[model samples]
Target: MSSVPQPPRWDVHRLPRARGRNFLVTGGNAGIGYFVAEQLAGTGATVVLGSRDRAKAEAAIGSIGSRVPGARVKHMPLDLADLDSLKASVDALGLDRLDAVVLNAGVALDRPPRRATGDGHELMFGTNHLGHFALTNHLAPLLTATPGSRIVTTGSFAAKSERLDLDDLQSTHDYRPKRAYARSKLAQMLFALELDRRLRAAGSTTLSVLVHPGGALDSLTPSRPPLHVRTTGERLSRLPLGLLVQGKDAAAWPAVQAVLDPSVHGGRMLSPRAFGLRGAPRIEPLWSHLADTTTAARLWTASRDLTGHDPTFTAPARSGGTEGPAAGPGEADASTG
Candidate 1:
């Protein structure tokens, strides 16, 4: 008889408590983000729901509170597609002591090429990579204050399918949705690994991890075709169908693990159990080929330069634009925001 297979041992619900810690979950209003925030708040952590919509953030906070009384969830406006908005939000609510940060707000802006976040970069790179890049850098002081702080950024299996185009990141020469998304994810890997190098070189112990959710419940999974095509595909996929992993909850698993897992080391990678696609979460090895020292260093330099930050490696970004405020009688600082 075929043995009953066991599932991966990780379940975010079974994770340890996060009491006394603070977290920021962007796009926390819905989908996997909702679960991530809910879980964090449920564990007694102070969570700030970052979103572009004030009303939506408020609703997310209410949802968290209703689900877990006195969950201590707060709302702040954060638009990943707009650096100005993120800068303002950081100034308004980004604290001096951040224990963890989740850079989850992303879009499949594969519809068309466009400038995003800030600095007139392409939409995919700007929103998926640069925006979070700025946010994390701006909040460096707060993160470092926590001593073993973790920075969690999302990656996708699409990296395997798409190659990097360093010369024209905006795809001015050759722009495809898949290529844009993959390059950004590749940047995510390079960014995380380089950060680890920088932290270790400076003798710092903070963890910067990258997690890919396989197929998860994310849009990365192509929707099935019509009934006839789907049926045939399903039958053919039987040899591998069981290995497919898909779902936001599943994707969130690896991310949650990377940040919360005590056993995880800096720069480590975690992914689903399926054949590079979807399932329960666990600590997997880094896609080691991504351990490109030259590439990592180069990407870091490019990112900092492109994002309007300085020192090519360390130091906070110089506020490039005129500062503004969220409401009456206040002005946001672009430098650290």
Candidate 2:
């Protein structure tokens, strides 16, 4: 393990053992999120599925139970579009430590001029970047205290089209759904790298890694009861697009690799090799602009201002439990029920 173990391509069936660990996968009820949760659970990890709909979460949990006998899976209500829900969910998640958190929930937008969140930010940006920012900040303490923990953010190839306007992060002045999505993704990529830098500087054990599933389509994935409702459209659509993209299970491979690959380190990005659209997972180069430090700092400040949650690198002391420093800049004390 001195050098990053280059597996014979990214294969979930070959993932390292993950027993006695806990993971939280946002949007784990469907799509690649669900498969990521499933793959991790198959390896004996306790997985918490975070979804906006409780019914969807429960359905996902049930599906996991049936797919992998004795899978340790649970559901928690989480709505990334609403910061209040984010706060409440964190308070309710009473875990002292989490091995990894995969930020996978987001609005996959295809139309423009959509609705905004309660916070008044653009929907995609709010849900994709801002909400995750708050959640990670709040959970920083638990992650920092957990040895060799990681945060894997789900990124996208759409980010290549982003033209960042730091002043107009929400794209309030001119809004197009695709560009809005791209901008949010660019922001996420920057934040991931920046967060890694900060975590290392703070001497925390936690690491931040970003991974993307390139052009994955739902049509090719296996159906889960009530959740993966296989539609005629999916079957028909797969005829043409099936060869062009990988399925959800295949797409989840990179994230799974990032989670268990001992060779992977913080600030690295894992993505598909075939034009970033379909193939085995690999570490690929990204747009230089997306990793600009100055922009990352600006986005970090804006995120703090918008969400009011900050990562202080340490958690407050807990009696009869793990303890660390008190809340300081950008950090919060334990939730006061």
Candidate 3:
């Protein structure tokens, strides 16, 4: 007789108290990012909501404050599609230390016309991979200074079905929306793995983790003003398929777990247990190709070349290190929203 399936060992819904800690969540204005921010703040962590639109950011902060009493939230305008905007926002934050950063912003729609960013790179690749690449490198020093800091890169199950063409990282010649998005997600996974290895090699305490929130429905997440407004159709549709497709709150569990769980270590991956669609977050083997070390290194090199940002950690001086924020050739700017 087949044995009954055991429940998840760790409770994904119930999070540990995180008072006095601080976190930054990209794309925190809506969907999974907003829910992740809420969850963190609900447990007493100060959350900074990063969004391109100030109104949306303030609205999200308000929503979080109303829902989670005593929630401390700040707004930092960030446009992931624009490098200069991201740098400016980071500078404005004036952060000396950060406990964790959740890189959750990206273009997920697999539509036609093959959009491109103002920087001339493919939209999906630029926003999902290069943008986060530059931002993380820019904040590496602050992250290194904070004990037990984590950099969680959000990936997707689609990475398993996508192929990365290192030669054409921008997808200049062959551009398909769905494939481009998949390749970008795959690049994110590779970057997370490589970053963990590099951080460890540098003897830094900061951890880099990879995670994916499988198939979450927007209908289930809170409706923020202006954006994330769930239409009647969406709410009605979710009524029948709620069990099959989990809400954004549940989907964000793995990312929040990656950040708060002390047991999670660098170079580890987390995702939903039930075939990546729904269930509690759990450690699982990466898709065979995404675990390729050689490819990860190559992606790292290519990212540095393209984004002009390096994550390599150097020893700080006894007095004060001279290493400053990374400065590279300016890329065209565009609104993430």
**Pick by lDDT: which candidate is best?**
3
Question: Across residues 146-265, which tens digit of lDDT does each residue of candidate 1 receive?
Answer: 666778877778886555667786667677777788888777777777887787776654678877767644343222221012244544555354456564555677777776666677
For candidate 3, give the lDDT of residue 150: 85
lDDT of each: 0.67, 0.80, 0.81
Instruction: Give the residue spans of candidate 1 off by over 4 A.
Output: 1-11, 113-118, 218-243, 310-337
Superpose all Cα atoms of candidate 3 onto the true structure and report the RMSD in Å to 1 decimal.
8.6
Lowest lDDT sum, 10 consecutive residues, model 2, at: 328-337
- Candidate 3 regions exceeding 4 Å error are 1-9, 222-240, 314-337
Full-model lDDT, candidate 2: 0.80
- Per-residue lDDT, model 3, residue 309, is 86
lDDT of 1: 0.67
Tens-digit lDDT string for candidate 3 (213-257): 988887865566555677787888787766766878888889988
CA lDDT, candidate 2, residue 167 = 83
Backbone clash tally (model 1) = 7
Q: Per model, how many backbone clashes are there?
A: 7, 0, 0
- Candidate 2 at 179: error in angstroms? 1.0
TM-score of each: 0.78, 0.87, 0.87
